[model samples]
Target chain A: MSFEKQKTDYMPVELVIGQHRGLLHYIIRPIVGDENLVDDCFSAVTEIIVKNYDKYDSSRGTLAAWLTKVARNGALSFVQNKKYAMTAGDRQDAARMEEVADRKTPEDHLIQKENLAELKEALKSLDKLEAEILLRKYYYMQETRQIGAELGLSERAVEGRLYRIKKKMMKKMGGAIHD
Target chain B: MTDFNEIKLEELLKETLPETSLAENLGVINPLGAAVNRVIAGMVMTTITLNFLGLNYILPTVGIMLIYLGMRTLRSGNLYFRLGWLTALGKLMLTTLNLVLQVTPYVSLMDGWGLWAGQAVHILFLLFLGLGIQKAGLDAGMTNPKMPTWPVILWQAVLIVLALTGINSWAVLIFMIWAWVRMVKHIYHCAADLKQAGYVVPVSTVWFSAKPLLLAYLAILLCVMTGASLLVHYTPLDAEKLVLAEAIGVKEETAEIRSELISKGFPESVLDRILDEDLADLGSVTDVDVLQSGDNTSNTERMEGYSVSVLTEDGRVKTFVWFEYVDGKHAGLVDSVKIQYDEDQVTTDIKGRLLYEKKGETWSADVKFEEKSRTYLWFGDITEDVWSISKYSFPFMADSPRGYFTWWTEEKDGSPAYWSFNNTVFNCLRTPLVLPYVELPENADRLILFGGFGSSWGQDKFQIYATAQFQ
Candidate 1:
């Protein structure tokens, strides 16, 4: 195809998605650790980005940041399904469990809602770098190596910092979280 | 205390983590400023030159480091940025080598190739770095990014052209400055656009942090340059045997001729230094007029003796200008020598030799003529004077008492700036007295010799020379 034709063939959303492919891959790769599964998860994230491109509000957050959240959620869902597919004997029962897992019981919701406020308050006490490290590790599901590469630290260094930060947060939270 | 396990803590943290902008949260250093500094630092390295205290070396070193720092923060933005960062590394290494070269004695030998190589790397650096910024802006989804990369490249080209052509127009300089300012402003605007467009630059970690690295680099460069300056300014002396005339003794061989010249009122000091072959040239000395001489009272510490001239049989006169130091520790060797004479008197028989006192004994060596050609720009036409302006650097034998003896028909008026003088002490002990004399055609009257000295020990030293009429 001619360059002009190729340029014209791309939709605005496709162009946006193409620009953010690396970011999406970064977000999805660790969560979906398997290479094949990462490819599938990246496609799912891009699909969501395309479907919701028009709904994107730049005033609220940047396109890359918004796509990051979407990609993270998509990768996490993919991992959960992959685990269920490998472990569960019945696909229909696994689907039922997935739906039921998405919904919350009243007691669980009440307990989580009460703990979340305290968690947010505890997170505020941590520095920006500490918060970033924790968020990347837990929320984005990035590996220690990936987090180290981003934060300019060795993998072991990142792991040590993460452990210490978790300990600090645990002490600060006290009995706010349950085992 | 509640026994909260690792898995539960991870789940709690993941659930409560804010759903904010990942780019904002992940971005540690300000990528926009880094991108701008990368280009700005490139310009600063190329433009400014502070010669005093090795600032010329230090500033450029710091500027290149800044470019590397900026590249580290922005390399992940795009392929262009990645390539730019790689190019910045190459530029840094090349610049550092050139900086080290500046402080060594080999600078003169490597000057031409080093300049070309430095310019080539600088061009590549600017090209790649500018493109990186431009690409980042375009990829950031700004339709009219108004990138300054091409303009900056064009400006760089113009600068290289100006440098190669040796253009020294104030108007061009002012225009270039204005263009530079405009390019910087454009870079700032491009950065603002990239930020607005939500361009996320992932910063990479360096083994060494930027500020400390720069400070360390600056400190090392300053120390190295200072060390090099000391090495070149004061050439080291050989510590072996200590005799020049004895190693190649011509005094006994030409004792009869030298005695005759001395009887004719020739300075015995000047005659002892004249080589056997040169002593033969002065054999037919029919008349010699020893001029009145005095001690240099310019400063109390340095005591350079006055100039003594002797007329030869062929009407050519030889002048002996002695620069003896009373306080050898505080004295400086002669850096430059300029012989100016009236334009009318002309002959092509100029010879000079240096007699220096080392370890309580006087050793002699012939003056080495340093040849130089300079090309300068002229507005109307490329004149002969501008193309190959010839000059000479008079070599000095150090560790006084030291002095220069020049035999010529007449000296012409010449600018001190045009004189190519090297301030280097000759290793008289290891090497025999090797003479490569320059024969300059006599074409002037009233010869006035000028010697410029710069001492590390702050001792004021100067030379005074006068022409004597043939008796």
Candidate 2:
């Protein structure tokens, strides 16, 4: 009833996962298109959520939002590992992760993190509508038709805006991106 | 080449975007935005006067629905929000009934207390809604969450006080509008602040989305309003079977009365179709004179007018302006006729009837007249004056249309009051309804009348006339 009383009732990780499991499933389903793998990716996302539950700071963001980042990353990694396994004679899980670790150097990781911070700052400078379109396309992994429908634009218009936005970001990042 | 893929942009942007923005973009509920909707709905539902195209009815319905939906989203956030949702539902029902009643003429006749009660319920709805929002912000650990709510309530109180005091001035109106704008901005800012603080509420799934629901409501309301308008467009008439026998008997009894009026120089065309009750009232019609009777020199239409005098049982002589249409072609072409009188003239009880030929016999059916009055307020005085004009629809092809008249006070000079005449043949397909444009009286303090305010009350000698010819 009281504000102090409510403050103590911080949400537990299980409750967070329980309430927003549908959201995590939505995020995972797109990347791991296979339904069976989607379930496996969601199970992996739950593991990450529990392991990092203590690190979640209420001041930083919401549980739903934090869970979203964890789910997206977990699902992407699961898909990459699955793809690598297919070419590597269906190698088991730990061997795939070790191979992925070998591909990126520690120095490379540091540079990428720094560049990401700079790109984040550049993103803040983009117009609000452009930022929304970019986030919906890349961050939320929404299809062009879905983005267009939500924003009341044609698919071609959304695609055009996305191209322009990506070009703008590439310039702002000092052409740091390359194939 | 950079080791970081472009896909890392999602990760970077995830951290960069505000939590509420991220949550909302991801299809999560923003409690503050829902609360702001309630504030906006409060503003919308209170406005009832700007009714062009029925916006007053429409906007309030939308506003009530927004409040209901907003409360539903926030109901899980706090107990106050649950109560607010119930109140919003009640307000929606009351508002819907009031809107339906507004389309009927009887709403004007209803007591003012019901309106006051509705206003009270609306205020309660806003109060609970605001409190719910404020409390939700506090529950979310927002600093100074009472903003917007307190300011909005203050402005609402000021407006209520101003309305109660009956202070009418442009300055006060401007100040109130400014306050409303400020309140709306404050509500937006408060919602933004709470959203930025990462306050999200669980949203209940709705069966129908907002736009479809609003469109459906508007469609229903428009249908109801149009149906109500059509219902009141015509006056109620008796079945043909019930009035047929009475009509036959009245014709026999009124034969002597009709002969007397004809001998006194009344037109036989006008006297033949007068209802027996009306004829009985005109029994002592001491005198009759034809004011105008002839074909127009410039046109094919024939015009006939009469002045009839009757001594009331109370012994007061009331002269009546009457018209008779004997030309079958003119009677067939005419659609509607209007009568007008000056503000000083005492005229009431306008009556009209259709005279049509069926199976080689002339028959009559009672037609109703609609009167519209224009009021003129005098300069620097509370005394108001009124001018009147009346019109009737001609539904059938009458062989001869008759019995259009209004009682009028005789002119002071004992001269026959003049009735002006104008005629137009309009293509019904191109122009369905024809209305005359009459200029208003020129007075310095008189309100400047605009287009379509053209129903005119003619010259000082109590001039009366019937206008409008049809094709």
Best by TM-score: 1
- Model 2 chain B worst lDDT window (10 residues): B425-434
lDDT of each structure? Answer: 0.55, 0.53
* A86 Cα displacement, candidate 1 (Å): 3.0
Q: Note the DockQ of each predicted structure.
A: 0.14, 0.08
The sequence of per-residue lDDT tens digits that candidate 2 reaches over residues B251-283 is 666677677777877666555545666665554
- Compared with the true structure, what per-residue lDDT tens digits does model 1 show for residues A82-111? 777777778987797788778978888887
Residue B42, candidate 2: Cα error in Å is 6.1
Q: For residue B282, what is the lDDT in candidate 1? A: 53
lDDT of 1 by residue, B1-471 (tens): 334466677777676664333335564222244445555665566567765554565577777877776676567767777887787787778776666555444555556786777777766766676566556556544454444457666876888788889988899879887987887776565445444332355556455445566678777865765455444444333233336655433556567767776787776765555556655555355555554234322332344444555555544555544444555532332133444443334433445554555556665555544433334556865432211011222123435544454544433442111111111121111111101111121111111112122232222223343545554
Model 2 TM-score on a 0 to 1 scale = 0.50
